[model samples]
Target: MKLKIKNKGDLIRLRNIIAYKVFKNSTKINKFVGYRIPRRKCDNYLVKSLIDITQIDASLIVDEVNYYGKMTMENRFDLLGSGWVRYRCDIKDDFRGQYEYRGIPWNVDIKTGYRWAADYLDENDCIHSPEGVDIKNVWELGRMNYLVPFSLHVLSETDRELQMAALIHYRNVIEDFTKNNPVGIGVNWVLPMEASIRISNILISYDVLKQTDDKDILDTEFTILIGQLVYSHIKFIWNNLEKNIFGGKNGNHYYSDIVGLLVATGYLQNKNVFTKKVYNYAREEFFKETKEQFYSEGGHFEGSTGYFKLVAEMAVFGTAMLIRNGEVIPGFVMERLYNNKNLAVSLRKTNHSYYSFGDCDSGRFVKVVPHGRFLSNSEAESKYLNLDGYTKIYGKAEKYFLEDDSSMDSLIRYTDGLIANTKNDTPSLEAVMVYQLAGKRLNYQKKYTNGNMGAEQNDKKVQISLNLEQSVLEKYPIKKSTELIDFKTQNKLLDFTLFSKMGFCVIRSDKASLLFRFGTNERSGHGHNDTLHYEYEVDGISHQKDPGTFTYTGYPEKRNAYRSAKAHNVPYYGQEQREFQGIFGYRTADNREIVEFTKSAIAVRYRNMYFEHIRRIVIRDNKVLVEDYGKRDFDIHRKMQLRKSPAYGVIDRNIET
Candidate 1:
């Protein structure tokens, strides 16, 4: 018996990690992968990917691939003949159309309808899809979903005309932007990170579909053209890396640019001197940035779960591409990714939702599904669209809520084929990977109708089960009822936590929890000016929240309001607000302190220019006792407020953030 590679664990650590080596010919590998996908329906293959990235068994790709295959078979001369001038679009829809610029819901639109039909808008004037029906900012929509329609055209191998029409649309869109919008000008091109993100989408889409195209000869030319446009995008990102790096802002956007460039070079196999140099520089910076952003103690110091979600995505996607391109992931990068997952898991509740602490700008580093959704409500979908036209035209278009996927789940699911953590449950050991010939999903259910299981179907569903050490798993203790127990003779519950390295003091009992933040505060970006701030939750429902970032930069006053100490459970003086240093800026001080911590109570201290603020909070039964001691007494006010766009329910009648 031969000892072949057993699981993803074995494959990940193989002596040669180069996926398709920098200079090696990939034709042989392509041939091997080609023989693999066609034998099964490609839809199920993508369902598995979606299941990993999102906890949904997404069949949208399957629907899309089937539709694209049909559309490709059609020869639409009118669409193919349309030039760049014909592709010109505008945002001059009715007054309601612009709300999608920030994903605001519409009364007449479907839940996912908050999309701009920017690029795909035809003289057809079809803004209504059964999936969603609303107006959106054209450019934002284009950047977010360009790959969805583009991939359909790429998969249309048999019909050159269909392929050409789709290709032409993509070409015209790029041509218009490049001709009119230079490096620093135009809406989409202004931010280098924006351009880089779109480029990453294009490249990833290209690689996924490139292997399975059936056109043996004629279609190859079209791919070459697509490659040319992709190369141009890479060059644009390359030119802007210095600005992104030199500004010295360690942001998710900066990391996005790096991840985009790294993934592109690895997949494109650009052996050019400059491209190679960019790849190497990006590789080193990625590691350094990882260490700085994610603390070894399993904390994301940027101080927001949302930003943590964004950056962790960059790490996962970028690392996956690098390994696919034949690069070995460093041990530290892998471990940090694990730590990143750990922080996310800690925040996760039983329903797969997260605990709110900081700002979440309503989206992710990568778009999980091809449509828009409500981040606040998991049930917000087409069934709630309240429009007959949407139902009539598209016929119960299924709404996919990708935003609900926990970052912890995404990490475990997407990396199923690439790497397996030994730390994972022993039952989840398998080497099964879904394969597809077309850039689409495989039909595992259809193929195995006669009690047969497809080889890819054998790929078990990825369970992101973690054997978290008892220290990391926070649990609530049983507390006696305040009415029944004698106040003086209460039994203390020993479930108090002191995250010393992270600067958090927590006191939790079975019915409620109290958290005081005295940790490192980020002076800029996702950090809030609520150090020494505390929050309270009763029975898993939020009572006192951090007022989390409502709309940073989007709504300036509100952003300031949410980040100000005034919005948290903290005592401050007068009506004077913390100095607003600019967008993404705050006033941070080395004021983190722990005055006292006992079995059932915690005392914390913070010093400002004139006074020292000491707060002692005790959790006994159903009641909380808060005692404030100020060395130099001044007019001090304490508060907590609720979010207008609340992510969780408010169990307490009187709510303040």
Candidate 2:
């Protein structure tokens, strides 16, 4: 959408953006070059924590690491968790900067294929082009996240032959990338956010390799080569910060750039004058964006649960690195992190999955766990249960299934490990790193009132309990043991919560769980026109589900269709809650309000431009009564033919209205 100043806040943000741009072009920040890695190495807290964690099998770690390591070596990758897609470089064992998607290579023409990152003017349009090639598929390969396991293995494993193989592969892959993808060129360098994420992973893996005992494998030449790579990434990210602050365009991308600066600065052993100034600037922006991007009530301001998990992962690692350097985390920062963790816990279903509400391309700052639906594609069912048009959104015919992602669960476990001073037998390397970086048990309870997060006045009114049988809770227990909840506890009542500011009212009972989404984000492009849309689950199975995001820029029509009101379960009156302006935003709609929310029932209303929708959901012993008090023609109980995008690229079309 074209930028419009609707409020003073918008005007102020725009002014700040102009000023920041002016300063970026005409200050010492512009004159700064980069720093090199120091020979002096500190204690590798991550490696130590991995060794200290309980119940980790040595043989399994070796096998899993080898599996992915060999896959990386063989050029096979599961991009965005959409099954394994393989591409062959024209030159064997070379990073030629060409990429592939579903066996179709794109941006392959040497003359017109890819350009220097600096030459691209309308970068977003290029990346999201409907030219039959998804840039994400290309950028995913450049992220080098697949090599993370090998990096961690070198530090923790004792097998000499295996460790040597991993070390060689890690060095070779990075060296190849640095050689081919120069400082500011190629499709890989098109976006600063991509560069930010890639550099962070590179430094993290490099950190693991540097601390390992194999000194000969990581010799002076390789270390210097890595030093040059880090310098290039830092320079590129500094020059190309995604600071298009008009109309809430800068969400996770800007946040990621700041976090990347912090990580890159943290990794620099020898800090020069220029590196020091950039580091200080990044530290200042990190805390400010925390307040702006995250809601005071604990949820991310952006509407997507997937983006929430992604930003949370970045925030947790950023916070951990800052804490490791002896920086005192501000009280407000701690409160947001803790509250976000609680929200993550609350969003977890009985089967340990979260509902994908907004645009979730399975984006992550880092990947620590090798298993989960996040890494693997959704499994197809033999027989189709085309409920709520589960098949149509995926663009398929009569086949239905939902992909599972546990990255949020991994974050929850990381927070649990931090506070409890234990890993709880979780294999998440990020969790152990956080626990070790904290240096001591974090007193999270002291930040927000008695381990609960929200405005102080509404704390009591926001949470209510409903009685459920022990058998039901046991039947669908959390897959991993986390300190967030004690399965062994005597409390048999599930807690229902309302994050008023974040606009999610969750009602739970013995029979079912319902989630109602209200509110509109003025400054976040991730907000969907899904107001008053509700998701219902019974006995740990999704009876009615929200059709998640498919592809963002690859198919603009599909992107808009997937996020429209008709795609949701709300009563459609042939008009959307808001009109779509672009792939990521909409013309502001009238905000939905909560009318009544109690133990037995929940009511919400959205006053649209054409008509008002007052949806009332009543909870009973064995069923839910969805009543819409609006236009007589609007049917709350209508068997609508909606579409659902289960995975990023996979689709199943098999239902109707």
Candidate 3:
């Protein structure tokens, strides 16, 4: 059959090609797959409600129109108002709404296939559909369900008129859809219900939908619909929380806390429906979980910095919500919140940077809330409003916390008393070490992890210093003199000797000082790859250089590597994974000790009995000394190699000075 052409020669060729295929495939598919399934009646209550409200007939509405066949007809409309209009029909499915609201006219041209129908499949035949055809196959038909009502502006109308028209159209469409109960088939059809409610509220706030004689009908209906959606979302979260917490599901309690906070905020803002009983129940559950999960030291039990921040933010928000609502805040909840804040603050260095351990976002350090915010529930919002005052308060508080020498003394004495009074029933030297290390020291700077000792100086050196006598080593059984001391201005030279009880630390002005740790019968569960790890400064940067601790559950890599022992900086020549090879008993031999003389070099030694490894470092003059002692018969094939990078200087100690 000769195809009739209207607008241009290209239009005729394209329509003929598509029409030919549609005729052929529609026949073949019907023969092979039988007739297409009829559209099922949609059971969507909301859509039905909308349709009833709009009083629109669902069946009579032309959802879509196919233009391929219609374009072959003789009748034409000037969509562009050009006398040379090319299309055969003025209102063909393809051109019907193309030029409406200032949209580009859909014209037939040859390049590749049509963009819209590139991935189009016919539900009738389970095959590709012809390009530029009104989507007829049930599968292709479902794509229309995902169409969202958007604002349209006609070129001739003013901005206000267009906006008002758009608003009326939106209301009409929403009403029609609610009454029609349209069945959405695709994943994209899942409307952003929450976003829609918020938008409707905003529109109401703008007075675009004014109250008139029909105010009760318009405003009351919209309000009830929005309320239903908000309540449904809140109820879903509440049910999930109960299932995760009380039902013993493996959901994270921290996630539960965040959801609770969100719910509380929504309720307080009058956006969600929450009963008094429900709120009380949520609060009770949150308190119970926080007390059980959070550590007294303020560290998150999950050992994740990211998770810690998430939980802390939730707690802060919850606290503010409770205070605003005139509810009583629990003491332990406040205490834990404060403790978490302190831990986060302590993790920061003098350079105002933080360690990226346990999935921490380093960039978040700049946005840290001041200490005063955690002091009282009311102050949570103060940081955002009174930033200058908050900064001053934080500065003053940090100075007092770090500079109070009397407080440090009292803490040390109190820790010593605890150690002395405790029996050896479950002797844990690691606990004592942590407690002693907990006290803040003033005028003494050291790098923790992943930081250089003198970062700002551009020297990028590693140097460190420690007060050996005042440290936790006084409680250990080993004599201080047997320990080796090594010192270096940079990484090059070396000065070495045995150290005294008043342990010394090598401090390179532009580098991190190295303090050696050696002790018997102590284990920190949160110990690093270096059981005898050295914490110091490198080029003015501090890092949690110690390899992190690990557990056997779920993480088989950690368990296989013997909790990262194979990756320790120390030498472990002959020990099997998990095998203890030293003189430590009951307690795991993980110690942090540095031996220093009155004015000479500083020697440090750390040994992990479990890994059968030792790292000995001595610092004197402008030189550094290092010795790796591993088990003599350890299997090199199974053992990990010691990877050392000596950056600054040559390692030589025998040259006579």
Question: Candidate 1: where are CA atoms >4 Å away?
Answer: 1-185, 211-218, 242-249, 325-328, 369-408, 411-419, 422-515, 575-577, 587-590, 596-603, 616-627, 632-643, 646-657
Models ranked on lDDT? 2, 1, 3
Q: What's each prediction's TM-score?
A: 0.59, 0.76, 0.35
Model 2 TM-score, 2 decimals: 0.76
lDDT of 2 by residue, 70-188 (tens): 55545555564344434444544522222221222323312124322322223555565544456666676677777666565555556787666666666657766654543443466
Encode model 1's per-residue lDDT on 1-657: one tens digit a residue.
112453332232121123223213333332222112232322211211111212212233434333333332221110100100112224222212322111111111122323322222121133233322222222333343335334543543446655544444433343344333322222343344666667666555554344433443215444454454445445556655533332465767668778877755665533556567878888877877777766554455566666667677677777765655456666666656655554454454333444556665544444433222322122332232222233343234333222232234444433332344323442211111111111121111111221111111223212222343122122212111112121221354635555444456455554555566765534435666666666656556654556655343334565577677777666665432346665466443446566455555566666655445666566655446665555444433444354433321111223443
Candidate 2 wrongly placed segments (more than 4 Å): 1-66, 94-122, 153-159, 213-215, 244-250, 371-403, 420-428, 437-441, 446-494, 620-623, 637-643, 652-657
Off by over 4 Å in 3: 1-229, 242-262, 265-274, 359-535, 542-657
Ranking by TM-score: 2, 1, 3
Clashes of each: 18, 12, 65
Give residue 509's error in model 2 in angstroms: 3.3
List the lowest-lDDT window of 10 residues for candidate 2.
Answer: 480-489
For lDDT, the strongest prediction is: 2
